[model samples]
Target chain A: MYLAQIHVTYKPSILDPQGVAIKDAMHRLDFDTVTDVTQGKYFEVTLSADSAADAEAEIEAICDRLLANPNMETYRYDVKELANQ
Target chain B: MYLAQIHVTYKPSILDPQGVAIKDAMHRLDFDTVTDVTQGKYFEVTLSADSAADAEAEIEAICDRLLANPNMETYRYDVKELANQ
Candidate 1:
């Protein structure tokens, strides 16, 4: 088994309104030090693949085709082996 | 400035229907190797703080009060100092 930890985040150019709202909320609650916030999605996936390289390739394909909206987001992932699961 | 990267995830005992849905979608799309999927929220918050330890403490407070549901979810964070921004 191999496990993939993926983070899908908005591109730098994108404006994140939800992040702005969170910052404002934080300030209202007196966390005045908060300056900025960026929100994103995290996924942990477990799969069986022939090799580490294969697992990474599969994860990339999954992100590109299903997990992320390529026009608005970019994703990065780490893949590692899991023994006998 | 200090940056805190946070991840909020469901407790292992909690059921993640969205994750199950995503895994099913993956399999239907022919990615049968997928065995499990776990989805969570990710955040990057930038704040002005006196020190990294203070920043981490603040981040933990924010997570406990706002970002996570104590009964269902748990959170972890990484804090680091950033060059003048």
Candidate 2:
């Protein structure tokens, strides 16, 4: 088995109203030191594959099709091989 | 400075179309063993503060405001103090 960790985030240039809202909330909550809050996503997946190569292929497919919105979001991933796999 | 690691994920009960699409993509890419792909987010922030208590307060503010979607998504976070801050 392989473990894949995926992250998805809005492009920095895009306007993130969610992030801005969070920043405003922080200011109101007395946490004045926090200057920015960027939102993103993460995924930890277990692959039933035997090797990293096999797992990478699968993970790439996942990112391309579902994990990322090619137009609005960008994704990156890391894969680790399980000892027992 | 303090560092915050924030993770956001879709509620387990919610339909994760993105995750499903990734799974299908994996299958098509010859990685049949990947059964699921649950997506989430992560954030690492450097705070301009000196203590964990202060940093925690700020990070909590961020979570409430922008880091998480309280309605459809769930979030969790971890904080660590940096040596120089």
Candidate 3:
């Protein structure tokens, strides 16, 4: 088995209103040291691939096709071999 | 400055329908090496804290108060001091 941890984040050019809202809320709650916040999606996927390379290929395809928007967002993933299948 | 990367995921006992749906989509896409999938929230927070320890403390508090629902989700974060600050 292999495990892939994927993070899909908005490109720096995108305006993230939700992140701004969260930062504003943090300030209201007096955590004023917070200077910036960016929100994104995280996914953990377990695969029954024969090798780590195959697992990574599958994950990359998955992210490109479904998890991330090529224009607005970018994604990266770390694939690791699981101790047990 | 400090940067904290926070991830909030559903507790093990919680049902993740979104994750199931994503996995189903993956199967339909013919990239069926995936055996399981879990989705979560990711946050990148920049703070002007005096030290990494302080930043970590603040992040923990932020997660507890706003980023995560204690009843259904659990959060973890990594905080490191920025060289430019």
Give TM per candidate: 0.98, 0.68, 0.97
Local error of candidate 3 at A81, Å? 0.7
Model 3 over residues A30-66: C-alpha lDDT tens digits? 9999999999999999988878888888888899999
Query: Per-residue lDDT of A1-85 in model 2, one digit per residue for the tens?
Result: 7889888888877887877776677677777787667777788788877578878887787778766889889988899977872
Candidate 1, residues A1-85: lDDT per residue as tens digits?
Answer: 9999999999999999989999999998999999999999999999999999999999999999999999999999999999884
Question: Which residue pairs collide in model 3, if any?
Answer: none
User: Across residues B21-62, which tens digit of lDDT does each residue of candidate 3 receive?
Assistant: 999999999877788999999999999877788889999999
The runs of at least 3 residues in candidate 3 whose Cα sits more than 4 Å from the true structure, single-residue gaps closed, are none
Candidate closer to the true structure by TM-score (higher is better), 1 or 3: 1
Better of 2 and 3 by TM-score: 3
List the global CA lDDT of all models: 0.95, 0.77, 0.93
Please report the candidate that would top TM-score against the real structure: 1
> Which residue pairs come into collision in candidate 2?
A1-A85, A22-B65, A22-B66, A40-B41, A41-B40, A41-B41, A42-B40, A42-B41, B1-B85
DockQ of 2: 0.49
* Candidate 2 local distance difference test against the native: 0.77
Candidate number with the higher lDDT (1 or 3): 1
- Candidate 2: tens digits of C-alpha lDDT, residues B1-85: 7778888888888988887876676677666787677767677666687678878876777677766788888877789876763
Each model's chain A TM-score: 0.97, 0.91, 0.96
TM-score of 1: 0.98
Off by over 4 Å in 1: none
Residue-wise lDDT of candidate 1 within B1-85, one digit each (tens)? 9999999999999999999999999999999999999999999999999998899999999998899999999999999999995
Model 2, position A63: C-alpha lDDT score: 78
